[model samples]
Target: KTTTAALIEITTTTATTTKTTTTTTITTTTTTTTATTTTTTTTTTTTTTSTSTTKAPIFNVNMLNNGDAETGPCETDSNVMNPPGWTCNGEITQLAYNNTFIYSRVNTIPGTAPGGCLFYGQISGYTSMWQTIDLTNYADPSLIDTGTVEFNLSAWLGGFINQNDRAGVSVTFLNQANQTTGSVTNIGPVTDTDRGSVTSFLFRQATGFVPVGARSATVLVYIIRAAGNVNDGYVDNVNIFMYQ
Candidate 1:
């Protein structure tokens, strides 16, 4: 059976009522049914979603921009700005297909995030990258209960062997005026791989949640070198997953 009707979309006002009606026909039968109007009292909610095929299992959407830093190639020193979602202070690092930087996730990881590249901090210095997301639309400034969001921010960090070489990501909560909301350093200070006082190429993950009453948030990725910058660490797969 085929049913035909003009499509009508309506967004009802709060403390309002919505009613819908339907008519069915089989040429031999006719039936008309009217749906009872639904009265909705005061209610408020905000939902934001971004699509992706490869995502962490916990969330149905990902809000990070070019979250894996593979939006394009991080070639040559002059073109470090290739990672689309962030303003970076570090170098863009890439993986050559000559058989290296390979792991289980690199083979099985999903989406637009390519597995062969990362961000790298310079040796003998500090490197930082940042991105911000506005949550003001999702929050009610006067109500703390309505102004909160929960999410996990993550980044994959690695570097050539050494004890002082370290990389980590931090998330800071901000108020609507771009002011700090008394929350910073969601997760951080992740160190590098070391063996008998010598640092080697290795990577790991660091992640944490954003605090409540945050009208916005800023994410930062940083690398620190205890010694020289040779074989300095690399970062990739930076991501954030909102609570479902």
Candidate 2:
């Protein structure tokens, strides 16, 4: 029994042991962003200038060609009434006085006229000087339609010291049918009354208006020698003006 009790105590003396272990975990995070940009540019420029356009109408006017008779017929001057741009309704002869050729009363003697080289016109018989002004396209028809336009006609006429010759000037406004739209007449600027009264000269002026629907103006400058060639008259510096 004693042996048996000793073996039981030895068996009870057997022991048991226990052990524990721990583990740790770690984490890391990161973020990134990218951007792009662009730009543009522009440019500009400017300039300026000046001009002239305010002159009066009187200084700048001419409806017909060669109205001044400066060119053609002669190198210097002539008495032939058949000038360019003008129709010779009749014939005239070139008459010279004191060595000055009769173109329009160019004085042969110095200090006689405004200029020594004056022109003398010898109109014989029933000869006439005629021209046409084309108002159909160039004129301000609106002004004429309202009877507000005026045509001014003028001329320098003279007598050869005791000449019985007389001349007359007239203007006729015509329609497209060639009919009279308006007219102005100074029939006998004759020897005693209008012309040849002075050694200098006479200036006669007539004014008229363009009738509505008129397209043209026909100018007639004529001379009448009452009896013989002694009726020969002179004319010079014919002018026509149009305005208000």
Candidate 3:
């Protein structure tokens, strides 16, 4: 009967949770932080250099034509003494150095000429010859006008033994009109005393600055016979050169 009394008994249930908060604190703080960096590069360059040079002009050539007296017909007689490049006055003869009529000995001339012949004044009186050179063909007009050009005039002059007979060479600078512009430059008249009274040639030269406004030149060769049937005044190796 007690059991049947009634099952009206109520049961109370309590649920307790011991949260083992392992606090894994995995704090998955997914803090997504991203850093960006930029880099720059620099470069250098090199270069090669070069140099240039210029050459100067040469001015050592002789400007006078037939300066050696080897061109054209040459003869031993005064009547046939017509040199190609010159104008003659008195008997201007081209004779071989070994002419038996005048030189008794072979090659009377101490020095040898290019053509074995040399200029000789064959007359008893004064004999003269000349040649005109056009500077326009050999040098710049400005150089002459500015007085910057220089000249070298040279010749071999000789005379007979103990005689006053002598040979000479000279230059006369002229303007375009052929008028004289400067004093004469001479290099000869080799006196008997200068040649030691011997029959031999002597080298003579004259150098000077060209006169201003000079455009042409006249080369004069002369012989003065003092005492001999044959002038015996010899000339050879005439030369003229221009330089800066």
Model 1 C-alpha lDDT per residue in residues 162-222, reported as the tens digit of each score: 4556677777778656788765664445454332333322333334444555667788877
Could you give me the TM-score of model 2 versus the true structure? 0.59
lDDT of 2 by residue, 73-153 (tens): 422333453555667755543333433344333343222223222222343466766888877445555546778777777
Instruction: Return the number of clashes found in candidate 1.
Output: 9
- Cα TM-score per model: 0.55, 0.59, 0.72
Global lDDT of model 1: 0.55
Q: Which tens-of-lDDT digit does each residue in 1-244 have in candidate 3? A: 4565666768777879787866555556687778767777676667767754333323667666666667776674335465667888877777666565576622655864556778888874988889888887777676577788889999898888888789999999999888999899999899999989888889999999889999889999998998968787888889888888
Superior candidate under TM-score, 2 versus 3: 3
Cα displacement (angstroms), candidate 1, residue 151, comes to: 1.3
In candidate 2, stretches whose alpha carbon ends up further than 4 angstroms from where it belongs are 1-69, 74-81, 93-123, 187-190, 193-197, 227-231
Error of 2 at 54 (Å): 19
Q: List the residue pairs that clash in candidate 1.
A: 123-229, 124-229, 160-200, 160-201, 161-199, 161-200, 161-201, 162-199, 162-200
TM-score rank order: 3, 2, 1
The C-alpha local distance difference test score for the whole of candidate 3 amounts to: 0.79
Ranking by lDDT: 3, 2, 1
Q: Which residues of candidate 1, in runs, are more than 4 Å off?
A: 1-60, 76-82, 90-114, 136-144, 193-212
> What's model 3's lDDT at 76?
47
